[model samples]
Structure formats: C-alpha cells, structure tokens
Target: MASRKAITRSQAVKYRDASKAGKAAILDLVCAVTGFNRDYARRALRQALVPRVV
Candidate 1:
C-alpha cells in the first residue's frame, strides 16, 4: 500500500479559505479529503482560521 501523505500548512490554509460553508461542513470536507480524524481536522482547521499575531 502507498504511504499516506501529510497535509501541509499551505493546504491547510487553502482549506481554511475554501471553507465558506459552516463549521460542520468544513470539518467534514477536511476529514474526508485529508483522511484525518475529525478531531485532528477540526483542530488544524481552527488553527488555520485563527489570525496570526505579528
């Protein structure tokens, strides 16, 4: 079997931008596409959505 690829920061950023839907949908899509668990995807998406402190 092929190895699973990890989601990159850029991809997470893109996912954050693409999540125009509600949080549930965003989490669903993230988990579905990345094959990440629900909790992990939620955390990643949440982190990506947060504004960075300069």
Candidate 2:
C-alpha cells in the first residue's frame, strides 16, 4: 500500500477555500489531488475546515 502524504497548512487552507466553490467541485479537486475516494475526501475536507483547539 502507498503511504499517505501529509498535507501542509497552506494546502489545507486552499482546500477550505476551494470548498466555497461547492461540494462537487471540491470533491473533484480533492479526489484528483489526493487520490482519495469521494466519501473519504468529503469527510477529510470537512474535518480540515474545523478550527483546531490549541
């Protein structure tokens, strides 16, 4: 199995912004970039948008 790469903070921010383009667009972008399935990409993007507690 291929190892998963960690996304940088900037990339996460990009994803969060791209989400404003709407679900279909964001899903396509995430899947194309990360090679993740629709469900996982959706969940991952959703989680990324959550504010981290320090």
Extract clashing residue pairs from model 2: none
lDDT by residue for model 2 (1-54), tens: 122234422245666666456657757766787788978776776676678899
Instruction: Name the candidate that leads on TM-score.
Output: 2
Where does the lowest 10-residue lDDT sum fall in candidate 2? 1-10
Q: What is the TM-score of each candidate against the true structure?
A: 0.50, 0.54
Candidate 1 Cα misplacement greater than 4 A, ranges: 1-21, 50-54
In candidate 2 the C-alpha lDDT for residue 28 amounts to 78
lDDT of 1 by residue, 22-42 (tens): 556756765777788988876
How large an RMSD does model 2 have?
A: 4.0
Residue 19, model 1: Cα distance from true site in angstroms: 11
- Candidate 2 Cα misplacement greater than 4 A, ranges: 1-21
| Ten-residue region with minimum lDDT total, candidate 1 | 1-10
